[model samples]
Target: MSDPITPTPEPADADAGTYGPFAYLTAPNSVLYRRVMRVLMVEKERFTVHVRPEQVYAGVAVDGGDAVTEEAVGNALESLADGRWGNLLAFPDSSRVTAIEDFYRRRMLFQLSRAGEAAERALAQYDAALGTRGSLQSVALEDIVALLITLRHTVSEHATGATVDAALAHQTLRSLRERFVELADNAVAFMGSIQRTIDLHDADVEAFLAYKEQLVDYLERFINDLLVRGAAIAELLGSLDAASIDVLVTIAAEREAVDAAPGEAETAAASARQAWLRQWSGLTDWFVSTPARESEAKLLRARARSAIPALLAVVRALHEKAGGRTDRTHDFVTLARWFATLPADGDRHRLWRSAFGLTPVRHLSITAATEDAWASADLGNVTPWADAPPLEISPQLRRTGAYERRGKAVRVTDRSVAKALLVDRARQEAEQTAAARRRILTGGPKPLSAFGVLDPESFRLFLALLGDALAAMGPNPETAQVHTSDGELTVTLIRTPGSGVAVINTADGTLAGPDHLVDIASAVDEAAGDLVNWAAG
Candidate 1:
């Protein structure tokens, strides 16, 4: 440990100078003084009494430091006791001793004086101001309203004052002017405060809603009242005598009136009357001069009016936040809250696997075979990653960063067999279709008499032609067309009015009766429009 501050002589009867917060340590780079004060303050807090040098030193010094010298500690004590440097008082004491030699000897107990205490409190306030750096302090709407009412009353009172008594009028004019300045300055700061409050609390939905409620109440109380007061001020200004006052001559006369003897009553009364006029002139000159764009009342009225819409916007924003009907971020907040409700040690692994359609857990002992037969790990494999390309990683493996173990590929057992069978069946159907299409194209159109026998494909075509002929009897012919569902083939039907029946045989059955004579024409596409032209004609 270092050393304790030495005892100084008890304080003498000397007048002290004013000191502000931490004034003793306010010297240029007074690091030592500041540390001593902090230690003393802490000791006082812990013990709830005065601090002695020894207590101060024990708190200041760290363990395993160079031993503190007695002279250096003593100098700090002297500084605390000195009238110019210290804000503390050193009281002489005989009850306790710090050293073995002074066990029964006298010492000094030090405590902060009133000035020092005030300074320390000021320092705390300074720190608090730093923490919440002021956004223009809210102007009390009540204060402005009160000032305006009082000012209008003062102006009116001057008009009816005693001819020789200007004392109240003069004082009232000065007060009104000062209050108006304050109102204007604070009006600006108040607007800034509202804007800053909005920006700061925009994301804090609960606080913004709360503030909006209060702001609504605040505006409600003030807005209508401001309108009424502004009207009163304007009407009062119109009635005030703006022309019959001269300040310089009245000021000179008032001074002379103050010096007048008691016998010179008439002379004193005349000066007093002049002074009253001067007071009225001063009030009216500033508030209601000639050729003005906006009087003080008008400016104040505008301020009160503008504040309403700004306040409404803030309320509208808060209303939007409270009802999560518009903002996308509100949905995100809800999802985050749901995630937060999950237990810290919840079994998320199973949920994650099912949600993403993952395969059953597998071991790497039976890895899938690859086309490259040479793709095997090196002998010894001291560092497997040294020569390996980026691994074929599963999404789950990438997230968990698993390396020591891996999953085997899930075997697709039925897909290939099912796929091969579908391919063979489709190929057979396609070959038969190609053969049928070639016969239809080569034979172009056929009379019903020539169709003596029908193969499976041709019989299918005959059934389609029957459908077309029956559909042509519809009232809405535009919707009834002889085209396949995929629109690849168009069929045209003809009724030849023949005298005898025609017959055809197929492998499935014999379709024999259709002889009132029908001919069939087929076209594969719209470009081969033989059927389309025949249908149109």
Candidate 2:
């Protein structure tokens, strides 16, 4: 008979060996022995069952720095099938499998690196979907909530698995967090886009509905992640409580109220009711509102003030809807009272100005009648209308020819009037110009002749004439100065120890110095003769 066939014992009883989720080894030679033996013995069966053992054995043999034999290969296959290599393949065991796992982990990291681009594409798709009217037709708050849930689930799953290093692990977690945040942000952005598009489409009711859907989506997530999460997240969520929900609710309710109306009167009544509801709702909605930080409070206040124009616009809309006319004077007084009670020096100024219709004055004009009345009135008797003259002329004025005046009174036509006005205007303009000039002149620490407005050429000419005249004088020099007063002109010369120079000043002066003075005098004499010649012509 052929040698008794020693059937390969089934893998189950081959090791009767203990196994664990992770692998380990003994000690000393166990370190190297287990590392070599684990891949050679334990992994062989799994590899041979799928493919050739030699193919898998080649990698282990190379790593173990050994030559493989058929017996060794068979033993490795048997041990792997029996699961007896307990401590041998433990995570502590640095083997080719660990390297393979590392390779795959790196690959996952590379995939994750592209996640941002994927998210961007997803966001673009979402935005495109929102832009279409058909996509919004049956969309509801529940749909957005469902989408968020899906996103959260997908991100959470992707974060799992030990296939990443510490750095990659942290990156993965951060990516997940950012993805959730982006989802929330995108939901908000999509809602806003939808609302804007609807508003442009002139579907106010639809726009309001879209806004309500956004609020519901945001508030649900806010309440869930913030209120249900750990204490830290809860605290963070609580910080967002200051956001005014009533504004959104009021907008929706107003639209609903108007849409539900059967007639104009009913619409008006509904609008009035909505207004009252909004006022109370606004107060109640913010009752628990507190900023997380002083800076946040400051920012909120600034933003609130910035929104005053929008608030007033809404109020005006509601007023019109209610068929109630706005009384500007009453509104101004009401606003003034409100502003007076506000905390000083916050963002209240902008709101206060808006509410009171306080606008920058572009131009101002005082009528002649108003000016005259102001002139006649005593300061102690001044009132709002104190400068407003009575329309009807007084009987005393009729007898005085005040009513029969052909044109403006002599007081208005006096030459002194124009002169005084001109002088006053000129003085004001001159003061302004001088102020600017002074600023430019004093801009630097030291003064320079270049800062002066005098033309360089003119100054050079005057200096040259002075130098020429000084040279003409004797060694003990005389300096002459010329000046004009009113219509008269004068030239004077004085001798100085160092030099003698001549200066000339003219009423309509073109040049200065002794040379110019002599030339000008000669020209005047010549002109007198020319005048006679021209008269003869």
Candidate 3:
């Protein structure tokens, strides 16, 4: 083996000739250059750092077929090792030379340079990003909650002047930030991919349906998890006092700044503290709602819910495509099949005429006299055009080309009575609905069990309010508040601690569930203009 090639320092900008780690990517012989580097890198992984030119030629020939030759591989390796490109470190294979003539041959062993390896890895990462179909990570949410809880305890201990472990604080903060970033990024990516899937125009029907079904289920599961964890995270964040949080932030910053230079420790700590505060702000804004706008968690949930209807619409379109009610193509195909089954030319011609009715009508000028004469006559298929009797034409039609008497113009029907009845019925129903709202709002906030018996309309309105509140909450929530879709009522439900079930008797049946303190109020002040009159008929 010859001595390893000693790398030299890169030349100045003007002398470097614009060559870089990625220079070979745009070169005319980039394909062959990449293949040579690939073979060398693969060999390097196997602890064969130095590869003979013949081995490289063999690998390149296999992957690139008849395009690569031994001479071509040698030339590419030499070009890559030159001072300009510098993608490989070349060594002479002097041990294989038996005679001086053999020495004259440019036999060399090649090893991939550091820059070349880094470029390959970067390209590999790029390819992976292109193929990635990101997913909603519920586990990340769980991890974030766990971290916040730990930090809260840590802050409480520090507040009481207890010694805190700086290393642990740093690690916890780092991990929390990392997990939060992963959650936010993956959610954005997942939602984007879902939009693409929904906008699929030419996808196979069966395949798209299967994917969309599973996608909807996945979204629902994630949304539920998001609601529960998001609320918990927001509450935890609010529970931490600003002073306690500052203590933890300082501890983490000091821990991070330990690696800084002696004179720069204070400056580094200040920078780290600022960075930590910024990250905390980001985390807080993601889960905590404000007066300016809603939290990202709630927005993501709404987007996910909207996606369900869009997916259903696509499914409906696919269903229509598979089995349409008025399929003209099917009709034409069936008619063609019928024409194909006919035996004789005459029979086919007759079937075509009967189906289309587009035959010439030169002898069809009928008059009242001819119509009476032919009333008892046989004009069947056996009668040809030449044998058929002639029909008389009216003298007025021949002279003026018109033979009908004029009549009076028709009057438009009057629907005032029907319109009045519809208006009266609508007014009555709206009054009834208003009465139900008033009845429910009479007894302020109380335990569900105290609501007593209810009319059917009141019972239905109560159920609707209950459903809206529960849906706004997660699968298992202790307290929830929501405004009905009609913007007329706001409902709040709080689960009370007990083993008793709240029983509500309606005119139809008795309803029982976990006892909850329920409150229903009119949203007239907040949504006066947007209120909708929800009436059941």
Off by over 4 Å in 2: 1-175, 187-202, 206-231, 234-319, 322-395, 399-537
Q: Per-model C-alpha lDDT, please? A: 0.56, 0.40, 0.81
Candidate 3, lDDT over the whole model: 0.81
Point out where model 1 deviates above 4 Å. Answer: 1-85, 89-167, 170-186, 242-537
TM-score of 1: 0.34
Which candidate would rank higher by TM-score, 2 or 3? 3
User: Which pairs clash in the backbone of model 1?
Assistant: none
Candidate 1: residue 195 lDDT (0-100): 62
Clash counts per candidate, in order, are 0, 12, 0
Writing each residue's lDDT as its tens digit, candidate 2 over 237-317 gives: 233232222322233344445546375755664675566455433322322233442222223233333333443454446
Rank by TM-score (best first) = 3, 1, 2
RMSD of each: 30.1, 35.9, 11.1
| lDDT over C-alpha atoms for residue 380 of model 2 | 35
- Cα-based TM-score, every candidate: 0.34, 0.19, 0.62
